[model samples]
Target chain A: MDVFEAVAEPTRRHLISLLAERERTAGELVDSLPALTQPAVSRHLRILRETGLVEVRPDGQRRIYALKPDGLQRIDDWITPYRRFWRDHLAALEQHLENQ
Target chain B: MDVFEAVAEPTRRHLISLLAERERTAGELVDSLPALTQPAVSRHLRILRETGLVEVRPDGQRRIYALKPDGLQRIDDWITPYRRFWRDHLAALEQHLENQ
Candidate 1:
């Protein structure tokens, strides 16, 4: 699964939000969501890691996870064009024409 | 599945990108993707509609689809916080502290 799929799960999105604030230990991540078990959190973390949306580093016994912003550039690039949908109508039309 | 899920599939992302350029009829979308069967494109369009990522309306005999920018706002909002991850180190640290 890519970053888009990795974030499709709400739990992973929550994990991302948590990491956006600061790098969190794996244990802290598990504790943040009381509804999920440690294994469930691990599963989600694994997806994020695999997708490159999050990176992990050894911190002795603990593993630290932080937002890997580069992985998100694809999503950002995809959404950039759609942003014109909300821009001034005249400007949008001009950009549209320029692309043609 | 929400907008994130709607866009998770590459075909759907392609559809969104097509719509981002301009509104397109169902047939146009199907034709743009040569490999996928018409039904497959229809199914993807259905999911896009359900997720509010794409809005559809009948234009005479054709159904036109366009990106529903409002639906993407949630994703844009969620990613806003993470944007700081790429900013200058000092700025990121200051923003982190401000949020605390």
Candidate 2:
């Protein structure tokens, strides 16, 4: 599955958000999502891993997972053209921030 | 549906890509996707409209569709943190351009 669909689920998006902060172990990711069963969360992680949006490595008995932001380039590229729609506003905001 | 899922469909994403260039008539959008039936195209447009990612207005006998980029902020905000993962590389490229 493409990264777009992989991150479509709310659970997966939540996982991406978590990994963005820092790398986490399999247990940590599962524990962070209280509403889901470990299996469900594991499935989401697997999809994320398969899509290359995430990378995992064995850390002794634990598996560490982190965001592999390269997969996100597809989304970034898609959004680039649309950014011009609001570029002037964003530029103005940047100007305001520089003056402050 | 949230904008994420709304744009998740490849067809819908294509439509957004087209609209990003400029507002397009309903016929123009439908014509752009040759593989999809007119009804299928209209359905995608309706979902985009209902999700607020796209807005449609009637122009005489035709309907016009345009991207309401504000709806895209959700995707942009979600992507903000992840951009940091590749920011340094992009910044380096920007610096190279500035130097030239």
Q: Which one wins on DockQ?
A: 2
lDDT of each: 0.85, 0.87
State the fraction of real interface contacts model 1 keeps: 0.42
| Tens-digit per-residue lDDT, B80-100, candidate 2 | 878978776578778999999
Residue B97 of model 2: what lDDT?
100
Q: Score the docking of each candidate (DockQ).
A: 0.40, 0.44
RMSD of each: 6.7, 5.3
lDDT of 1: 0.85
Quality class of the docking in candidate 1, CAPRI style: acceptable
For candidate 1, write residues A44-65 as lDDT tens digits: 9999999989899999999999
Worst-scoring 10-residue span by lDDT in model 2 chain B? B84-93
lDDT for each residue of candidate 2 in A42-70, tens digit (9 for 90 to 100)? 99999999999989999899999998857
Instruction: In candidate 1, list every pair of residues with a backbone clash.
Output: none
- Give the Å shift of residue B23 in candidate 1: 1.9
